[model samples]
Target: MLITISSLLNQTELAETRDALETVEWSDGAKTAGRTARNVKQNRQADLSGSRGQALHELLLRKISGHPVLQAAARPAKFSRLLISETADHGGYGDHTDNALMGRGAARIRTDLSFTLFLSEPARYEGGELVIDMPGYTQAVKPDAGDLVLYPSGTIHQVAPVTKGTRIACVGWLQSLIRDAACREILFDMENLRASLRASLPQGSRELLTLDKSIANLVRLWAET
Candidate 1:
């Protein structure tokens, strides 16, 4: 499921988040990396923690609680973890698979989706493009401050180094209701079809009702509770 959900956060929310992040204490980029991750991750960066991360976490929950796209992608997911905090000053993660284990017990799960919430405008930084490696696609995304980019968790991706200024973004993982990526892809396609069908139908038409029911049933059967 190679998907991109852009502009996930509105301008007002982005402003608040940016303000909050500015005050958070940051550490050496090297300290945030795991033993295995050290070889790949480089540049000056830090993780969100303590009161600062807690406030940001709560804020994000409130903001995303009613988001339709997020709701659809993260079905059955009660909440998402603010697993990684990124503050870049010519900082960025190198090319690496996030699937590796951290400690003896700590490890990555079947994360269905990944998200990057941009906290800086394009003009504020140089480079720092998110490079995602798909089967046949290598995408470079550098969206606006309030915009977001969501994609599959399995794809290998990295952040291009910032040449000047700074780049701040929030990264997280989603444990979707439908754990299988293929299943999620099918559901997403079906939902798209359902929307298209509804738009083409006349109000109170028989076809609309029938298609709606079918769609509902599919969601009911496949969706995780």
Candidate 2:
């Protein structure tokens, strides 16, 4: 299930992240791409080992961890290292799926979902749309700065080449506790319904209690860990 979380980062946080990015050094992004994908990937990636890069990574993790909608939709169990990608001068990634697993040994994470957090404003770049090929249709995404797009990692997707200014985004993959995308979608819908009912119904309403029980039971049945 594909979902979008608008304004994942506040203005002040976005400004700070953009400022820090300006001072960090970047390297070839293909270095980390899968063997087949490396042939078509053309972009730059920030060195995460650098102080500024590490700080940005931490900030993003904190924000994502606290987001209620994201928590409900993703149910993330483990995450791969974040990638700060910059594309310009016709650079773009060709159609390819993310690796099934990332990291090694105890740190390994099975990628079930992928996300892109936009850092550059839409007006700051031309093209560079994140295009995903769905079963029956294709979707091209280009959200405003601070927005995010989350989709299944197995989808065939690509970054359309940037024709004008630079495009910067934070990309990552995660292993969901609820491994089935359909199950995750159902849970997300239930969570939204529960929240709405909670706001309108009295505390401990029977309908709300029933929904809570069903959701909990479903999670218990579907959750991996």
Candidate 3:
């Protein structure tokens, strides 16, 4: 399942992030990519080891974790360090899947889902679309600044070449409590239904209670941790 969350960051937060990004130094993104991916990954990445990078990472993490829709869709158990990447002058990544596991030793996490939070407006760049090979058809994504797109990490995907200007985004992966994507989709639908029902139904209504029970039981049956 692919999910898009519009305006994940507000205008003020977006401005703060963009301003901070301007001051950070960038390096070849291939240095962090897997061996095979390194061959096709052509972009610049902000040095996450610096103070500014760490602060930006923390700020985005807080925003993502606090979002209700993301929580319902991902059910994230653990997260990888956010990558602030910039692509310009035809730089792009070829089709490749993310590493199944990320980090080392105690911090390692299985990448069940991947996400990209666009930091630059679409109008500022040209031809930098996130192309994903879906089950039957391929999808090209280009969302507004501050929007986020979430998809399964195992899918073959690529960043289309940026012919003009620049494309900057914060990319990351997460290990979800529910490993199965279909299960997560079902639960997400149920959660939305529950939210809608809550607005119209009386408190402690039997229908609401039954739905709550069903969702909880499914989580018990499917959750990895």
Candidate 1 segments exceeding 4 Å error: 29-34, 43-49, 74-79, 83-89, 100-109, 199-204
How big is the RMSD of model 3?
Answer: 0.8
Candidates in descending lDDT order: 3, 2, 1
The TM-scores of all predictions, comma-separated, are 0.81, 0.98, 0.98
> Per-residue lDDT tens digits of candidate 2, residues 52-140?
78888899988876688889999999988888999999999999999999999978999999999999999999999999988899999
lDDT, candidate 1, 133-154, per-residue tens:
9889799999887666777777
Candidate 3, residues 118-225, lDDT tens digits: the string is 999999999999999989999999999999999999999999999999999999999999998999999999999999999999989999999999999999999998
The TM-score measured for candidate 1 stands at 0.81
Q: Which candidate gets the maximum lDDT versus the true structure?
A: 3
Candidate 2 weakest lDDT stretch, 10 residues: 61-70
Against the correct fold, how does model 2 do in TM-score?
Answer: 0.98
- Backbone clashes (count) for model 1: 0
What does the lDDT come to for candidate 2? 0.93
Candidate lDDT (C-alpha), each: 0.69, 0.93, 0.94
